[model samples]
Target: MLVPLYNHTVETPAAFFLVGIPGLQSSYLWLAISLSAMYTIALLGNTLIVTVIYLDSTLQEPMYCFLCVLAAVDLVMASSVVPKMVSIFSSGHSSISFNACFTQMYFVHTTTAVETGLLLAMAFDRYVAICKPLHYQRILTPQVMLGMIVAIVSRAFISMTPLSWMLTHLPFCGSNVVLHSYCEHMAVAKLACADSMPSSLYSLIASSIIVGSDVAFIAASYNLILKAVFGLSSKNARWKALSTCGSHVGVMALFYLPGLVSIYIAWLGQDMVPLHIQVLLADMYLIIPPTLNPIIYGLRTKQIRERIWGLLTCCLLDHFSQNS
Candidate 1:
């Protein structure tokens, strides 16, 4: 009786239920409004970034090219996961098909990996621009930049395929409810009846290779950048060089630190951390970076800020004209 019941349970859960927050049933309205605001901001900000970069031919440099890549990736990342999450929170319907869950997991992981790679590319661009100003153009030619984008996207897709395949094959004999709003690889894996050690190990290895190594390379690039900046004879030159990298560095820290912490707690201290805290951190790991990235990059870079100001002023003038 027990064996049959176990088999039936494992095979029966065709869909998984997603609970956005475990103890927040009474506050779904507030949560939905907050999440909707975040999602809207992320979408609008990234879209504006892409549009500004495209419209202003002066911003056609490699840095802006990579910025476009980052914005596009953030757009996809937010779109892939947030709408479903908002719907779940708003309507109180949490059921997601197993196949849909895996699809979401794949896009989330792939876009994240692509963002990590794009960050590394941006770091290298800065390194070349600052450290080897004479050779920057030759090093990051249009052809080369295109190749890097292709490689970054391809690598992300290939790396996640095996992990997603493994996840799809897992038999989820336990409860079909996922505790978080989105389908994280580890979150979903935890619900499987089979031993998920292999999946976890693979995830660790992939993350190390994609995220960890990119971080290491980014740090090295920044170190070289600092050394070069300090070597400049003029203080203004030094300040300008440092200022150029400030936004990228801030974005990197915002994205990686929370991510590392979330990964740590998810794997090691899942029981130690409170469920609410874990859920918040998990959501922030994805949402905060995309939401803040546009603001940080936009305000810090003069070209983007000027374009944004121009656009905003034009809109205001148009509104006033219509009202009058």
Candidate 2:
């Protein structure tokens, strides 16, 4: 543990190699193409969401502001990993510098933590809007929304900094080849020659604390929402209320379910699970949510759907006029 202070002189590799889907090494070209497509879609979708929200004054509500934050986070998160993943798959040049690896780890965790906070904030926004409509505006004022964003980012930074520091301080004397497409916490931790117990425990505890609490809060908020929806005498009102929450529920499920499954597979199926399967699950955990989030929101939320249609129509009309 204390070896980090003196280990600079030790023969540690300056960079670590990312072994992306060891079994698919023969078809990395095809895999790269597929992943590139997904990355492109994610980038386009999230970018469109952010841009539409910004340009459409009607979407300047607290709910859409939180959504913009989510899309931005998703963009950063996808950007942080997918480009490197593409490079590794296409060129087979998977070497990432030690400093760079830690940086990736930091950003991945930080973005994930921040996204969770944003989801919770979204839940709160929904709760206020649906349950206490009168005070919704009062509760989620501009200052409060700004403060929530600041708090979300700040909390993620404060929480994940120590994990990165711990990883940096660990002495790595083992093979520098990481067996995944990205720099995951446990994957990197397990590479250290030092006792990785503390790192493992910290990762588990931190994830459990943050994820658990966010899930609980979101669940509680939804419970209240459900109660409010059911309490209404009108069946149409109930359906409308449920419809408003459908996209959020879909997003929350998309974000968490695969994540939980990936964590279990990574932890429990380390030896039994095929490397490709684990890699796929892990990649899905990261990419799927970002890729689908915008689509779900745009399709399920009437306001966003109409706004997107209007924007697309405007673009097409402009394009035709310019050509004419």
Candidate 3:
């Protein structure tokens, strides 16, 4: 039997210690505060988006239906990682049991994959609305929208299951310390005593293929949308069409840019990027998009904005009437 590091005789660690960020121990308090605020914003914003869409019958179109799915995904994605990360940052160190760690890893990756699918769906939604306006309703009926949602959720869970299973099979006779705040797949896989090359390569390839394919489809969608928009004879009509896509584009950039950076940096090895920087990028990639998505949509989408504003006005009026 091989002796383990850290004076352990077991082949696998019982729990993993999460260090919030390498070399940033002294800033844990500040980091915790910032992360907590972002998590709070993400929770409230996404919840509000879901509630608003649900309450307003007028907002039951395909686009708003897809927006509700995106908000739900954001809620799950942020919730899976942020609370534990906040705990780690606040305590300076946190230990998660092996099962719990793997569970978190599964949720994080699964939700991420689902969100990617949702973004692609939204892009397709836009493409149809812009390119096939006359047939938009016929093409994206309630039944079809439901089917798409089911497909997205099913594909995400199926694709991410193998990755989690592969990680759980690896021997962890070495260190039990995970160098990041959250239990990321690569970060946890690196702690295994066994040769983790297969896991790493699988992760890199799977992530690249999934993200790359979705991005290509989304790009192609926008390309056709822009072409159709520009082909409109009236400047106002072109502007109107492009404006509808602005929020989706902003949300996409916020999600994919930092995510791509984090993915590639992990693939390139920690030598090129500082470990702390990599961790921060990973954190921001998950946190920032959820925090800003609702805000972007609320500001850019007229119907959602009007519904939100109307709700606020009603609440304020009720409060004043009661007080007076």
Candidate 4:
């Protein structure tokens, strides 16, 4: 048995063992390979998005600015969990120090909230560009954009702070084994010797409020945007406006659907869904979105696509010239 961080007098364990997926120990090799592949793609894709946007002056609009933030959030979200998860599956070294686990938990939750906020911001950007074209620049000026990003990050930190705080206060005795991949809030809380209802309830409520409200606002923005698009007399204009939003809408669906499913399974579907499926969904929720966001944007958004193609062409030419 693993040694406890403190003697019987203590409440928390020194390290927690993470079981990647319960009852699937035999599949650890394949699981590790899959996660490692997806994580590599996520790192490369999001990094390229951020780099292209930063280097290309023509892409320095509000939409691209928010895309850069979204890429950055995707990077943070994937980095927070995937490396340790891959290690757990590949090496059977599932032990995570108490501080490291909480830190991972904080980054995972905070980046999730920040991503939701960014989606809302992007939706608003689309709405302004489509609905109030004349004021797009004025409405989302450098000052306003900066303020929005700062507020989104700050709000996430403030809201998610309680999750870790509540977990810390609870008395964790006995088993330090976390059933899910990483140190998820509810997973760790359930190990506490004391009643964990409050922590669970708080997490559910906070997630609901943050995701629910942001989604509602995003819906409202798109609703107005649609109305404005239809009002346009030119068919080409309508298509152009919608094409701009297609990537954002796709990204939102990719993010919110899996996230909601994971939350539901964690909070309510314990008896309905198998434990392994629930853990898989939770892992995919973090993995899939980050892996796909850049692909969706790079292919759907014309400017980004052209810029990426140019960059690739330059690299290929440089490599051939060096060989010659």
Q: Give the TM-score of candidate 1.
A: 0.88
- Clash list (residue pairs), candidate 2: none
Q: What is the lDDT, from 0 to 100, of the residue 134 in candidate 4?
A: 97
Query: lDDT tens digits, residues 163-265, model 4?
Result: 7777766667779899999988878877888888887898999999999999999999998998998898999988987776666677788788877887877
TM-score of each: 0.88, 0.89, 0.90, 0.90
Order by lDDT, highest first: 4, 3, 2, 1
Better of 1 and 2 by lDDT: 2
Instruction: For each of the candidates, give the backbone clash count.
Output: 0, 0, 0, 1
> Relative to the true structure, how large is the alpha-carbon lDDT of every model?
0.84, 0.85, 0.85, 0.86
Q: What is the per-residue lDDT of model 1 for residues 116-217, given as tens digits with 9 covering 90 to 100?
A: 999899889989988899998889999999999999999998898888877777777769889888887788889888888888889888887788899999
Among these predicted structures, which one has the highest lDDT?
Answer: 4
Instruction: Give the Cα-based TM-score of candidate 2 against the true structure.
Output: 0.89
- Evaluate candidate 2 by giving its C-alpha RMSD to the native, one decimal: 3.0
**By TM-score, how accurate is candidate 3?**
0.90
Task: State model 4's lDDT.
Answer: 0.86
Per-candidate Cα RMSD to the true structure, in Å, reads 4.4, 3.0, 3.8, 3.3
